[model samples]
Target chain A: MNEFLEQFLVEARELVEQATADLLALEREPDDRASLDGSFRAFHTLKGGAGIVDFAAMAHAMHAAEDVLSTVRKGDRPVTPDMIGECLTCLDQVVQWLDAIEDSGELPGEADAEADLLAARFAARAAASEGAKANSPVLGTAPSSATALAVLQEQIALLAVRGEGLEGRIASAGRLAANIFRHLGRFDDAERIAGSVSESLAGLDTTSIARSIESALERLADKLSPSQIAPVAVRPDPLSRTLRINAERVEALVSLTGELTVANNAIGHIAMLAQEGDNPLAAGIADEHRKLDRLIAGLQRAVLELRVLPMRGVFQRFSRLVREMSESLTKPVRLTIEGEDTHADKAIIEMLSDPLLHVVRNAMDHGVETCAERASAGKPAIATIHLRARREGEHVVVEVEDDGRGIDPNRIRKTVVERNLAAADAVAGMSDEALVDLIFMPGLSTATDVTDLSGRGVGMDAVRASVERLGGRVQLETRLGSGSTVRFLLPFSVMMTEVMTVEAGGQLFGIPLDAVVETVRIPREEIRSVGHAHAFVLRNRTIPLLGLGQTLGWAKVESDSDATVVVASTGGLLGGLEVDKLGSRMDVMLKPLEGILSGIPEIAGTTVLGDGGVLLVLDVKELLR
Target chain B: MALTILVVDDSKLARMAVAKVLGGLCPDWTRVEAANADEALAAMHEKTPDLAVLDFNMPGRDGLDVAAQIRGLRPSMPMAVISANHQKEIVDRAHALGAVFLSKPLTEPALRDFLAGAVRQIEAGAA
Candidate 1:
């Protein structure tokens, strides 16, 4: 796309989002003038953006919405649910058109029909409100100048009062008169008012200030006609200090940084080889390698920082969704988002959108009860779904919690048995906690009838899969009658993985350092065999042991007099993996297994080693399972 | 002779918009841009400009506050205070500081009028 169109798309999308938020806020608080003005300005700017892009249809639609908003701003029409809905619908159409333009890099050819339909709907709403306004004797009939004059007169009366704060009142009245005159384009009258007010203030003469303001008010009443004092046209706020960089460009930079890290690793390896030789230059080469490593690390950190973005972009869309769902389901729902400014990798944020959609849809469809049902059950009629994101150590934790009907373990248990996902006797013995976990099993939905919204028997499982694909885990916590919170614990960033390379049975493997607790060596006599598996004791705790070579189906080599074990922890379980040697730690960009290697339970992914060899990174949880 | 104009706004986009308009109106006029009150004050200290345009709504000190300080330094300097918020208080403050109030998004004709008035003020002060 040309730069101008691209800029327009970015700006127009932001305006749409802003307008949607403001309209929703207005729906919640009809008297919120800030939201009213914000919506008006957003639509006005959106229309400007459309005009710049030469998209007349979008401009026409936006102009209609702006006109209705203008009426609301003027207090001629009160904000109604129907009006907010129409404005939201208009925004929805604009979003669709924006999507089309982004995809095709040009204005959509067939947008006129949709725009015309939306514009007509908005115009009808405006006209209907105007008709009602016309019938009312108190509204839309008084001239705005009369209101300004009334305000000035009130100020004059206050100034005339000989109160303790009389001086303050005089100053305020003087300011009011000056503003009134300036707004009327009578600059000289405004200057005269200002001059008199300042001179009076210097002399502490409140009467003179009031007299000057009264005369200015009289002049304004005579000269300022109704047509002269037009309503102030709301404009956009100051632009934020942000740059719109293409996501692909950042991804490309990440890839290049990863390549540089690999190259630096190769240099370190060469330095090691040189150190092994008896040459004077070996020390110099090693020094250069250390310097290069530091530079590469800084570069990697900067590149990763570039990919970090706040969670607001993903969280802001849920407000509109909840509103629409509340309307359709006949349930009053409120969505509260917290910690949306928590930063996470852009890739993680993008991948979270679909899974979050599924979870939120499920929350609305199956979790929240109808308003009538809620009121009868001694709960508030309005259901609140709280979407929160926060940084916890090296993880970005997202939670979608709803105050509604919690997931019933009994329902899940029955569904599990009916779906044949688990044996009846086994499910009967399972605890309620375990039974609730069965919801994550595919095709184990408890809803009797499938709804178009969420209960398609494919939501929770997909949510788990998507989160796990990012090396994250999904957890659910619920009470029988309270509510359910679906928590996703995800890695802060997926671009790089830090692993400790270990030599096992003459072959090398990579273990994610996050799971590495501690390594120890124990005498062969101290190890015991139990049920054909070896076990060992470390720090007075018994940890099961697995030979990496045997697990990979390679020929097992006899251990030396002492066994070297790498202790790894995953999913609250600790296991010692027997290795021949512990290698150095390094950062690598993990590539997901492709083709036949994909879906391997024990192997998580592969990374390129300094020797140009592939290192299989283990999924410690799956490996121990 | 060409004259230099100082434009101060917290938003880079707002500064660019003002600069673009000024460039079109007075191609020979040099423009100096500042993002905040401190930068604007510093620019004035370095070299005073013939005309100034300041955004009323900024981060630290508002445009009128800065205008008041400029008025202390050069009492007769012609200035315009620009803001999207057309509140009466802001306009009154701008007028008290001897600056014209211009609503945003600023139009070509409105800016042209302000510049013409400013030029006449500078000429009158020189005479």
Candidate 2:
């Protein structure tokens, strides 16, 4: 691929994004002049770009859409939803073309047929609008033809200026006349004028060329009716101060930084070993280790910052999705986005799209009420779904809130019992919040009938699982009659995690330190059997206990002494794990389990320890569940 | 002597396209590029070029607007106003400003003819 094509791909994608944003904005506010003109210019410039690359099919398609927008700009037609839809459809095709070009390093071979269909759609919409204005004087020809004739007359007048560059000026006038004729679809006249201009240019005779253009204008004036010419509006181009870098390169840098931090930790381990031996250089080695640790910490932070991206890109996509969903379901729902500028790690943002899509879809499908239902319930006819994001402490919290019928705790309780997920007596004794949380249980769905958008029994649990895999948590709050909001609390970055290593089944495993409340030594006799489970009293509160060796299916060693226990909290529930021993704490970069091991929910990921051993990190939430 | 030609377009791709063609046609001539009218005018003020190729549709001020200003400074400089949009208003304005109107995507044949005419005019004026 040439440099021009590469640049074109990048720029064309940006233009498509900008144009889609503008069209969506126009859909909300039809009379917004800035958005209308912005959409027009984006399309105009996009068409020009296609022309530059000799992509005639794309240029032709864009020209059709641009003409419709030009009519709206001229006040001949109002900005209708149908018009916006057609233009958006055109942009979608452009996006597909851009992707194809990027993949193949050239224009797609099959674009012509797609472009034709898109152009036909725009042309049909334009013709329908033109039919409505049948009474107008300019019937067959567009108003631009009149402007072309006026320009032809202007070119003739310009011939009167006999000056230093007269020869070039005359050649330019001839080319302009021929082009205008061609633009009006008068091919024969365009050719004749072009031929005559070439002849006149060879002789340097201004009078003959002027006569030829005047005669052509006279003939054209009879066919083109006069129309008002609108002045072209000017808008300032936005300047970009940021540079575009390849995403893979950034990922590679992040991986290298992770390895460097691990190497630095190894140095710290060596320094500790030196101190243990009482070596003469122990103090100096420890001091140097501390300095390396601080510098690596800064480098880690700077590298992580490169991957931070604003949530706007992810949030903006929901607008179009919600719009299409609203139309398809025949429901009037408006998606209001807030705090889109909140930043998150790029990996988190990329993984967020699917989960967010499911959440928003569920909110609209099951949470928001229909217009009729809302009207009878004394609520507004149009329901609103708020997609919000914000930074809260060490986490970025993304929330999807709806203003409609909230999730009924009774329905969830019934579904839990029907699905046999929990005992009926236990569910009955649970609070409304606890009952609602049961919606995250797999195979439990309150909706009686499944819809295409959601309610296939694989939603909230998957959402929770995905969030947990990213070292995050999901929370749901519902107000029975009002609405529901699902909040995802995600870490600001996912690379580095502080973990406390524990000896379980004679092997070392790392448990995320954030979940560890405290470590204790408790007599084995204090653990009371609670029907297939075990519980122990800690500070007057009964906490469930699990033997790590037994849970991991390892050979248990018979011991009568006090058991070493690590108390941890996951999903707001406290639990104690009996391990063989508890080790020191260290920050390690986690790599998610891939291939066959990925199916195990209890193990979140693995990290390389300083001694080059793999430390398996436990997912406390998944384990407790 | 090699001459300097000013190329102005808001779209970097369009500017590059023209530069690519011009590079092939006139390798000895120096090409100066500007992204918008401000930069184009600034370049003109810094050093008047022997020729200019301007895009008709740009942000802030279109190409013809810049051409008119350039005409005020150097009336006899050969210029071509290029645009994908072939509206009569732009063509007439280009003609009124004594500029050759070239439609885009600018073809080699069309640009080559304009450059040939420009070189002849420049050499004639020098003589």
Candidate 3:
């Protein structure tokens, strides 16, 4: 993933968690002010986030939810449990779609059904409210010069509650409203309110309201004039959201990253050839290499960072998620989230939305204890789920922890044994930690009954696998009586890494810096070919030598050159990449090739050299498989 | 009345899509198609259109050149330019040439809304 996308994944995961918890809480207490405020804030924050990240679909949906919340907050309407339920369902769909987008660049086919249902419900609610107001004027009708005095009185009364700073402006609005009423020949009512209008207007903040009243009076006077034979049409305001950028600019960035690599390699070669003795020329070359390396690294970082987007883009769906999930589960779990300003690769964030939701739902349905249970357990009646994120060295660590009935190891152990995953005898020898780890095993579940939330069978293993695929690791740690914490450690960015240069099938390839554990040059006599797979016993460990050419469907040939075996680790498994040469570590941008060219399993992407030659960056994780 | 319209484009798909949307919205309009500025001018002499929707970029004569020429010939004629890319430079140029700007890929609602606004402005100005 790119920097923007990577940051987005980390941030989006947190937002999803918050949204789910809030939704669950809102279900329990629909009229709770804090719950309502939090749900609205989550939606608003998610909408703003989605807008910046160009997640238009999520932004559009969140915007609709925001409209509902804004209307509710303005005291114009009430949020019902059913409405919250629908919103949470929408959230689930969006989360699933987001996950789909993360794993695959597009949403799955079923996302449209959820979007349509939510949109229709949103539209129906808006329409119903609009129809009610249209049928009943209630305390207010559309403001006109004839009703301006009443409008002024209402404003003055409202503003008076807030105190005196805006009194002067409010008084002016009252006067303007009276004038408009007089112009419209409603002088009888106008004259009655004219006495107190000035004092009332003075006690309000009516700058814009006063101006609008004045404009209305002017228009009314014009309309009443006998000389006005034809109606004059007012022009419409210009509104647009379109921009243009040069296509060449993006291509230029790609070329610059390539040039940096060439210059970097040349500097290294010059430094290596310097005199044996400590000389000024030799030191100068070394110094130049260091400076050039930093310069290139900075340039690469700057270019890659362009793709970084804030996590808020994906978080917007969470607000609706919270609204939906809270009602569905018949539980109240208020989500408190922070650190949304975190940025990451847009692609990574887009993919992160779903996995985050699964984790959240899993927490709410299975992790967080019920309100009565929590109170009986000497904890607060409501569960508090916290999601916190921050950068650690070259990776971003995102943790989702809830204060609830912690993971029950015995429950998981029984489930695993009943499912025939492990022998009953073996369960005794296994530690509590080992028993708890079973929750993440594929097709494992501890829920006694299957419901809409959790218990349907898919568990934490899917999330763990997806996180690992993004060059990250997922670890689960829980206290038996406390709560469970799932921490994901992912690289800050994926485009640029310190890769070890290796030659395979006589072609140069790069192994990711994190994947390579060690590189050893073993004598050819020690290498033995076993059933088409090359194996070498390094020290005591038997490692299989994965042929880069044979595995990738490239032309295979026998070579006389000494082999350099690079040991790499992928998904807790060790493998070796046998190559003819081992070059020094070099930094290069990972550029995914166009279309089907990138479909090659062994190749992660392609990078360009200063000389314009393409270097295939090998996917060490994929290669090991 | 059969309202005459000038359609400018370089991309075949974009032109077809825009035409289809226009046809769907205002089926009475008579469309005059042009691949570039040179073709647009040749078609312009054959008949003067009531309105023109020009594409900003093309190999021979870009949308801006054609819009400028239309402005010189008939300043009051309703003219709008469609652009795919979002660049202030091109938008400013279109504005300077006295044309409404619409960015693609043009959905049905977007196209209809732009046309409605443009038509109202044109008819209001004429009145």
Candidate 4:
């Protein structure tokens, strides 16, 4: 699931609750915009959320409910008790759909009935309104729809205006005929439009035009029966239509071939190295070694790239979600999606969606606000959520930022202490930003009760765990009452590893580059002691330093004032690690720990370097804890 | 005329990749690489290429800065931005600065399309 969907789950659940409440309230007083807006938001958000999870059935159902509410919102049709009942029932069905989705990752079969009924109600109301308004459109608020329809009607008229023979007329009339054909349930006409639209939009924004076509198809679905609605081949797996074979895979395969060539050369070199002859094998060994080195280097490059996938795959789903949430919450939000082409590995991308969702939801539910509240604060009622991705050095950083209520670090401190999750003294000394991070701790929630949207203690921890398992870090930044942003620093891919070879205890241990911050030579004079614990002054701050020998229960070396230190940090905690020597960075594939060795909390994974030597990758986060 | 192109990116590797792709496609065209927009601007002041390919996100004065400056300095100079950040604001700004916008991880297809478009625009302007 993407960030929008996860956030939508929380928002949808909340929307369902709100929708139910709004429905009950509307039963008594139907004109309240708050209730109507709330109900609309719930359905709209539910539709968007369902779309993200690929729960098309639920999305379709919610779309129907949204259409009805949207029409009512425009006052094109009055919000009758029957409409309210049906809308509320739709909400219940959506809730049930969400439940089913959660249970099975799919909406129930035969679920489209409710959506069809609701859509029929909307279409019937629209027809009745059309009958009543012979002079003007009854839905008088939005001119956009009217303008578009006028365009359609004009095109239909022009087809009659221009009879035949002129090639221009044939093309223009063809388009109009196709538009009328698609909307008027003429399969042949719709196909013509599809063909022309595909051709015309060839050099234009293909995605947007396709999306518009998709919307047109959706709107047409209400008028036609199920069989007629799916006119033309529905283009089986339309997703695959746009999907290109991931270039990273091709790049990786190329690099692997390069590596295999090097490995073969290395085998020849090893054979020559074994038969150490003064004049016989030395030249052959040198030549083979050079080839082996070249091939290995090429292989490493390919493997690293295999982890790099375009960021677009992870960023695409949020747009529909933001659209839904903005409408439902009655907070106009435009998603500013950036870095769609920023690639990261598939595993990291998959792991990323959950955390991003939680953060975005947190921003929407608790961070952003009602229109009235926003107006009072002199902020736009329609908030802006920036979903951005970038490659910062070796890490893929994803940020979900909203222009709503910034998180109150003070509130976090209070929540932490009140919940008894941490000591008051610890939180008191901690910066407000650090206090905010307490949200990621297990069983830590500031919300009093589990609302549909927030106060569910599952979000931050799940995000943190998922990101960490993918060899990444998550950070939360918020301004007091302004808005908040949660960023995940993820590896390019989960499969490839970047390890820094370090000498510790006379053995070469490969520490994952993700864990190592910087290798610095700690001078003897700068090292001090805070009682029995060793400390070092870095940038005028006393940071606790640990020797790998002592931290990992290995025997300590004899006194040496100057120590080679690996400065490392994870999820925020920073410390210096003493090691013998810093080695070169190498790409290695991680092999999982087995048996009792797996129980070692400080070891992340083990990998084999090009030299066919096994090196243990340390888990810096575990050591910091 | 074979178009002379300049590629600007903060990352040497990324710059090399674009150069490699361009070199493979239009080997006759002269391609120069710059690390930052400022350097690119300075390089252009010396000898402006037929077109400049810029990276949008950079440490100092980004692609937008280079684009706006280039547009101001030489109105007819064709420029294209290969951006990791495909924000609408950036795209709008690029268009406003008379620069063509291309999203990053610049594959052969995207680059080919962009180059073709740039060549046409430049040729049209010249005409």
Top candidate (DockQ)? 2
Instruction: State the C-alpha lDDT per candidate.
Output: 0.78, 0.81, 0.65, 0.66
Candidate 2 residue runs with Cα over 4 Å from true position: A1-241, A529-533, A571-574, A594-602, B1-5, B23-30, B35-51, B56-78, B84-99, B118-127
Off by over 4 Å in 3: A1-290, A409-440, A455-459, A521-564, A593-597, A610-612, B1-127
Q: Candidate 1, which CAPRI tier?
A: incorrect
Docking class of 3: incorrect
What is the C-alpha lDDT profile of model 2 across A149-231, one tens digit per residue?
54566667678887778788788788777766664445667787878877778888788778878777766655442211121
Local accuracy of candidate 4 as per-residue lDDT tens digits, A45-86: 455446545567677667777778778888887878767766
Q: State which candidate has the highest TM-score.
A: 2
For model 1, the interface Cα RMSD in angstroms equals 5.2
Quote each prediction's TM-score.
0.58, 0.69, 0.47, 0.49
Q: Write the per-residue lDDT of candidate 4 for residues B20-120, one digit (tens) a residue.
A: 67988898998878888778988887767888898876655878898888888888887888664366988998888888888765678888887888788
Candidate 2's error at A136, in angstroms?
A: 18
Order of models, best DockQ first: 2, 1, 3, 4
How would the docking of model 2 be graded? acceptable
Share of reference contacts found in each model: 0.00, 0.56, 0.00, 0.00
**What DockQ results do all the predictions give, each relative to the true complex?**
0.09, 0.47, 0.02, 0.01
Q: Which pairs of residues clash in candidate 1, taking residues 3 or more apart in a chain or in different chains?
A: none
Find the 10 residues in a row with the least total lDDT in model 3 chain A: A228-237
Ranking by TM-score: 2, 1, 4, 3
lDDT string for model 3 (A1-625, tens) is 3333433444454555566677678778767776666666566545444543445666667767767876777778766765676567556555555555555544344343244335545655575566622221132222221133334344444444555556654554455455545533445545644655554455444444444444544444443321111111111111121332233574477467766667676667667767465556998888878898888877777765665555555554554454346545645555655555566765566667777888878888888776677768898655656665666777767777877678888887888788898889998688887787777778788877787886666858888878866668888889866888888787777666567787766777888877889988777777789997888898899998876666766777766666678899866568887776787676777777778785687787777654456778888877887
